[model samples]
Target: MDTHSRSFAKALSWRATGTIDTMIISLVITGSIKLAAAIGATEVVTKSLLYYLHERAWLKIPYGRKTAS
Candidate 1:
């Protein structure tokens, strides 16, 4: 089983990559660094929480997991 801290750490690292991608897309569409940054900042918080929850939820499922005897 994965611990809460491990989930949180994974969330943070994934968010960093996702945030950068979001900022780049936002900048291209809006042509504004400020707006892109704001979008990225908001995404970091919201998506991180969502991702952490999603990860934890998946851990509860038994599908596709192998167990040692």
Candidate 2:
């Protein structure tokens, strides 16, 4: 498993990207800045937790991972 900080940073970066994308999509579909921002805010928190857990889980599985020299 990777260090908590590494996983957290990765999650934060991924969540930032995902939140931007979500905001764009939500804005286009909903045509409401407030609604879009709300959706983005929700995704930022929920997806960050999900992404961190997902990364941790993947780190535990050794399949297809190469060992460092």
Quick one: best lDDT, which candidate? 1
Using TM-score as the measure, which candidate wins?
Answer: 1
Local accuracy of candidate 2 as per-residue lDDT tens digits, 1-69: 579999999999989998999999999999999999999999899999999999988888989988889
Model 1: per-residue lDDT, tens digit, 1-69?
Answer: 999999999999999999999999999999999999999999999999999999999999999999998
In model 1, where do residues sit more than 4 Å from their true spots?
A: none
Model 1's C-alpha root-mean-square deviation from the true structure amounts to: 0.6
In model 1, where is the ten-residue run with the lowest total lDDT?
60-69
**RMSD per prediction, one decimal?**
0.6, 1.3
Every model's TM-score: 0.97, 0.90
- Regions of model 2 farther than 4 Å from truth: none
